[model samples]
Target: MLNTSEHPWKLVGPWYRPSSLGGYAVTKTALNRFSAPIIQKYADANFANNLVNEPQHSLRFNSEDFVQPFSGDPNQVITPIERAQSHTPLKLYLNTHSRFYVVVCELHCDVAGFPQVERNKVCEAGFVVRRRVPVITPELKGKVETLLQQRSQLQNDLNKVNMQVKTAQLQESQQSSDISGLLKTKSARLFSGLQSGTAEKLTEKLQDTNGQLDQLSQSGDIKIELQGWKSSDLKGVGNWLPIEETPEQITEQVIPMYPLIADPTNPNHSANGKTLWFGVIPTSLADVDSNNNPRFDDADLYEIRCFVRRHHSQFPIQKNHTDCCGDVIWSEATEGYQIAAHFDLDGTSHRPVNIKLPDLPAIRNQVNNAPAGRGASARIIAPAESSLNFATDSMDMPQGGEPLTRAGQQICFFSIFLFFIVAMFLFRLFLPILLFIFNLWFLLKLKFCIPPSFQFDAGLVGSLNFDGSFGADFNASIDAHVELMTEFTADLAVQVAIEGPDLEAKFNQPNFSITVNKGKDNEKTYVDEGVLANDLGLMIANGINASDDMRADIKNGGDSPGLSSLSLNELAGIFIAMQTEYQDVKHPELAGILPTPDSGLVYFEKVELNKEAA
Candidate 1:
């Protein structure tokens, strides 16, 4: 870190960082030489410019000092009055992109031990605006409490209405289904093959059922009857008139009322002695009818009257304003012909103030008595059997006044029981077959979609004799197949096929072997070339019988050929024996170089390093 005491100048905002440094650090001497004097002169010249940017008659203005070397000044005003007279040392902590700061400061060093300083460059300097600390006043606190209470009450009312609607919907659905089923039965009999007299009677019964169903449908409707007090219930606010317009246009035109907080820190910053204006009518009463006649104008006047009835005593009297509450004055000069209130003009005011308006009243008597659950009371009328019948008719008749006989009821019960039994028997017979088909399809997907593996091979092309020595070479092939055995497990089978001139004499192994043993059981199965076909058949058959949970166990009883235990001399002896097995053997005396077991020499296979490498 540079010594901040010596280099007190710090540059902020959108400047280039040549070396990814935090910020530009410049010496105070450099700032004094370049930027300090220019900023101080400008601030002094504009000291009298207030928030309005008006020039003062007292202070002298110098137009030439404001000009910079490169960029022109965009603002004509010298300075705002908000920057009060400064007597202390000039510390120019600026806003973002406010003005340019050009300083001759060392930005980089060369190999020769010399530093570079930027000269008179037009660099834009900007400062950030941060929020002031929160200040709460008593009026704000009271308004917050009132808003919270209103929201809680409205939310409770909404929840009650939602639950009532849901219950009515469920009951309506059940009733509709019952009525429809009774009509369907009557309709079927009316159209079925029967005598004319029977068909006519069924038709009349269906008509009567439909009429009762219509009455039930009307009864189920939710007709909420609200009894709350409207704004019109209040007494003498004003002769308010609502403007005729659509709700959409009215909403766009209306501005919500807001309270202004006076700032005490600056006397000229406050809008103190002014008459605030508001539209005298509420938005609910402003609308145009289909016939183009004005609506709600009379209602809006009554609403303002009610508002004055409640708060007229609190109104302050203004000179010569007596038609209504003197606090609110009718002014046609204001937009929307609004009512106005004169505020105290003292510029030092810095507190929240309250303005009352006409709103819907909250009364428990009106709210509690409103129609709630199941909606308003309704009379459900019974269907008449005939238009001419006036009296001597039972109102609540079962099955349209044609109650079933005892024998008919018994027949209906037996038929329903028989139908249920048949349905159960059919369902039981087909369920197992469907389950078996699903299982088969699942297994087939697993078998056909298993991933396939790739294999590679590398070997010597042919046998070649070394310098004055007999050497033999071999060709080898490596192949692998991957098969998924269980849901999460897989089996990899690898086959190594090697061929040479003297293979049968050394290894004592067949041309091919199906060695199914992995590292675990240490078992190896060797199959001769002639019996390869028969062994493959047995393997496939075993695979078919294996279940999803099956695993292989091919444990060998002995160690791996016992060849690893042999010494180099013993191994040479076995090679000598292999030479005799070959008909035309070369390098017959190569075994003479082999070391004895007492010499403590071993092959690579016996070494720990070779095992780890493998």
Candidate 2:
């Protein structure tokens, strides 16, 4: 909760009142307290005392002091005209008691009714103070110096380590160059028939070199070693200190005066005029007791903040229109024109008068229609196929023609048939040549095709010769045997031809004739039982009687024996035999001359075999 007590310096008056009467009496007293003459007297006394006590130290004054008496003749005095000419209407010293006070005036008016003429009067006035006090003690100063020295030492150590890192990096670079040279040497020796012992020794040396390089790489990573250095280890390093509570944190309090109070006769009327208000307000109320009264000797009175409010036109100008209804209107609108001024006990004040409002309309338009102006157009045309149109008007053709004679038709038909026959014969004769040409062209194309970088070495290592001749001696012998073989001969005799002619008779009755044929057949059959018996004995002795009853039964649709009939030992033996056979077939030695087969599926198997061997 905030206290809402009226400020002691609040003053109010009507515009018709004299400056010396009523609330104006207090205003006159405050003005005389901080008058120019009084401020000058204080400044001059301080300047003289500072010179006598600390002559070695230069005296300092506010910028408003046009003529510094300490810088010139200590006895010299500056005139009021000279001070005004220097743009300093009032010359005051910050250390003087009058510097911390300020006067504010406000005007009030009625904004609800008809227009009326009224003098400007002061509605309210007040004074405020604000100041900064030193909180750094002697013990804190000693601790700060110690912290700074520690920081400096830490920086020096860091620089030393950085230098060492640079040196190590240079050494690593040289080692890298040496390793590169060694690699080149090793590659050359590997390809140039280097001895096995020498190559093995070089490889060992390279491994050791690589180990050294790895160590160098690990050594350069100093970040892990630096983990012990923590910023929290420094002095005065912790969570941020909370804001210290001060008396200046009090909220601004306003006190109403007589003019602001409602009166039955005056109603909402108020005269506008400037009124002065002044009093000593403590910048800090830390010295105040429980009774809300501050000790002037112990209270801070070097700074003050004044808040002033004045009434302005209550009716805002309507957008796109400018009419006020021809009447002045006023309201008790607390959110009126406000001015905040900060006055320090040191003769300086900070008052912000210029304020800028943001342009929201332009920003809103830009965001809503950023890309409204962008547009695009496109035209697409479909492709048309090439075409040809021929004109038939140029062609010469008879609309009607006479029929050919029979001979002419026969001739035309024969000629047509002959032309077809000849054409077919020529086609058949040239078909083989055309096919040969096409085949030759395809073969030439294949021969000229681009080849890949890798190719199989299918070239034969040696020439092959095939013997195709038959045995000449064997054929000659067969021909000689055929020449030596005898030929069959047949002889016929006609000695009784004349004698049989006399005995011959012809029968005329239906040419009937009886013919008697006489034939003599002589056949001799010889049976060699002994030879047959010998041949039978030899056939019997040479015959083989072999049989597979199980195979025969299976062929006849009988079930074969199952492995379940075998003992466990027997089954194990069979399994081992199968595994051994598989191993024998897949062994590397049986992989032919090449490690991989022609199909390349055995490449992984070969690789595994090599790995096992290595």
Q: Model 1: per-residue lDDT, tens digit, 131-191? A: 1112234545564445435544433333333333343333334433565444433433332
Q: Please give me the total number of clashing residue pairs in predicted model 1.
A: 14
Candidate 1's TM-score = 0.12
Tell me the lDDT of candidate 2: 0.25
lDDT of 2 at 449: 17
TM-score of 2: 0.16
Superposed on all Cα atoms, the candidates' RMSDs to the truth, in angstroms, are 41.5, 53.0
TM for every model, in the order presented, reads 0.12, 0.16
Clashes of 2: 15
Q: Can you give the lDDT of residue 212 in candidate 1?
A: 48
